[model samples]
Target: MYVAVKGGEKAISQAHKLLAKRRRGDTGLAELSVAQIREQLPLAVDRVMTEGSIHDPELAALAIKQAAGDLVEAIFLLRAYRTTLSRFYVSEAIDTGGMRVERRISATFKDLPGGQVLGSTFDYTHRLLDFRLLAEGDAETSSPTARDSEPEPEPEEEAGPMGRVLQMLEREGLLVPEQDDDQLPADITEVARSYPCDRSARLQSLVRGDEGFLLALAYSTQRGYGRNHPFAGEIRVGEVSLTLIPEELGFPVEIGTLQVTECEMINGFTRLPDGEVKFTRGYGLAFGQSERKSMAMALVDRALQADDYDEERSSPAQQEEFVLSHCDNVEASGFVSHLKLPHYVDFQSELELLRRLQSETDVAQPVEEQA
Candidate 1:
């Protein structure tokens, strides 16, 4: 025990030093710039921002570097830093209808007014690694293709203000009308409480929840646990403007725009008390090009709503307490890592008890007579 404790202390110290050295790489090599990470590794920054519940890309990039690229650690660092800031004002809820869309798609209807715009995506890319990337200065820069001598045909008709597909179903009495909530949303950061919370509070917790945990829970649902057959009614990726009302100004003003990913999931219908069948919906939104996270979140959100439909809640995904309690990577990391702390006192007591029990057992046993 003494050796283990001493060795662990030494090892931890050396490991930290080694990590710092590795993170910096060679003294002759140029240090990695935070700007590079923010620009080139945008998805990593997105994950940090989503889980950290913070909106600053620069800060997220720094956290990623400080944490040596461990996304969960970066998220924890960013979240911790967020608590130190002062709240100047709360922004008005964003209006997605006005989003300047870069990408939008619907699985429910391909022939929707706005034909699917497949933006920058890896969906059709072959998974082969380009060896040319290993060679420096191989990046090609080319100008946009020249327009034909003939005047460009009139641009495809812009889809009149893209409306939600689910809204159409609701209009036809095919889906339940959305519940109106006048109560202020519960802020999980301030409340720091357990489950049995409202949908607003639950969704607040879920947006910042661990992506892997949410993904696994969502996958379980697809495999028949808390199955809520879901169709991606719409997944939109774009920039949405934020507006904050300043007390001094006495009017709302645009702060800035934020890149975000939002998903609306349509689920199987259930019969109401009035014997009317209506479709259900789950919604998810997150920072920057986070399609998978949003989709997974939508699935889990619908799964956790099983109680509202009077469905069996036997699945882990459907149990609000179980899912919310274990989904924070920060909490899980601390609890799991705490086992490495010194437990000498506890071990000593157990060791003494074992010795006493063995002594008593030896005394109570008879010596072998014939041997």
Candidate 2:
């Protein structure tokens, strides 16, 4: 007598059609274009690029529009697309010092060799809602800046291999010099023996990590979990060279360039094991202008670097394997969502236990009455 959901397929098809109509909204209005989404919702695009691990703003914007402004869904779309793409070649380590600087600032220093360029940022803007933006035909373009107002580029002075700012102070005998093992950084994928260790790969991972996870890890340091008085030494955003070492050509080849944001945090520290005092440093880098994430990442990076600083590592943020491995949004999302899938067998076992308990309670009630 139980005809088990015979129209399940029909119902699913009808539901999908209804969803499509709802998402499209009233057909009388002009549909949102990809270009409009790209220009209007840039912050969403930036988040998609950062969390999705894709650098193309246009593609990220498209994903955002397709996902109906759901940032996590946009990230998922980008991540899925990224997996399908083939790796042609690995680029060389970009020279951050030689970046075509767009935005640069330092909280630690008032005047650095490179004067700060506060490019396009929302930092100083008031948080009040702009009603004009919600209205059609109200958007206006500002006049372009005068060409003469541009600042001259810094001279091509080959700064010695961009050493840690703190390390420079340590060299003057003002701070403690941590022991340096001559061990070269292992080729990250050598254990698998497939991919090589390169700046591109490292940046790719950082940009795609969950924003909230990075923020939390960074906050832990300030909250006394790791305890570091971190000052944003410098935060820079610009484009850097991407080079490839071809198998046929032994020398590195200039493939192209990419925009990147780099953050360096200086921490106050009293050196131990040698009774020396010195400033320590932490570094973070990512693709695009993700200053918040980059800055947070820098703080977390510094806290994790405590092991190198000879400081006690008791915090979860200091654990490299734990932090780096679990910071991915895709992994977190999948693991969390997977729990919603059918667990009927497990539910049945729980139901049986509850029934047994109820039966035992009923039997005890009669025994209690007799007593």
Candidate 3:
């Protein structure tokens, strides 16, 4: 058994070497740099950072290259790296209201403050495949001229504070007022797992949860399952500065800025005691310019708000445990991937049991025939 275990360890080490070699691919081709992925494929890096619950773009980019562009695997790598780091300071709450607005839009209003700055988007893009991109890739490798061929961007006008649309409704006394609690928000990473989690914990979970899973849940809500009449109150993408107060300083100090996407989905499913109907909100905040994930998170957030409003919990989205438990892709992937591990002993035992049962059945049949 000892010898067999030693051999297995050697095999695993060799397998890792093969994997590393395969990850490198054809050596003649230029090796993809972490900088290229961080700058060029930024959205992928953003997704990795967001899902991984880590905020380092360079680290995320390195993880992406190491994982061979597998974003989920990259997320796994980032999470694993996170486990090694010591928690220094929990940064002060991010102030999205003071964001350096890059993209801001509202579906409920035709026009509003900051006037729909569509900074960078694929919303108006034609779905047709552009073979030019393939040619461009080839040109980038073969020709240096192709690198700076794209036209330079124009100078932008000085922008004002991009105000929240929800504020406008709030001024009209039409929006539901939020609890003015000064309670420090709990960190999900620090806390022990509990069922039917609080708002802060739930938000943290949804923020870092699987994007595709949340998107599907959001789609289901829109398609009438746990449907809440949602209007995109606001969807904003931009950079927000982070501040942390060290124990020594006792004052807030600027740490760094992170690109974030925030979505506020207004739902009219609840009424007030004053006999005047008001719009309740579902909010989502994620790292980088992740509009879809934030929006989906908002929808799922609203659906999960069913308990607060005494709404029927008939849909999968409304069931907090069901969504929260299964949403962590890392946990889900680990369980699913464990199938690749050896189940030799279990299989052998099952095989022997099956044969013994078959033999007993054969003996019973022969005895019955003789009788």
lDDT of 1 by residue, 257-289 (tens): 999999999999999889999888888899999
Root mean square deviation (Cα) for candidate 1: 3.8
| CA lDDT for candidate 3 | 0.87
**TM-score winner:** 1
Tens-digit per-residue lDDT, 168-233, candidate 3: 888888888666588887688888558778888889899789999999999999999999999999
Sorted by lDDT (best first), the order is 3, 1, 2
Clashes of 2: 0
Question: After TM-score superposition, what is the CA distance of residue 116 in candidate 1 from its true location, in Å?
Answer: 1.1
Tens digits of per-residue lDDT for model 2 on 1-371? 11223447988899888876876789999898889888877767777887887678899988987777778888999989988897776567688877887788778655455455678888898998989988977876675474646745653433223334444566787644546465443433233212222333333445567778888988988898888888887888888988889988899888778888889777876665677677776667777777888888777767666666677878987766676667788878888877776676777888999999988888879777567
Order the numbered candidates by TM-score, best leading.
1, 3, 2
Clashes of each: 0, 0, 0
After superposition on all CA atoms, how large is the RMSD of candidate 3?
A: 5.0
How does residue 340 of candidate 1 score in lDDT? Answer: 79
| RMSD of each candidate relative to the true structure | 3.8, 5.7, 5.0
Which residue pairs of candidate 1 clash? none
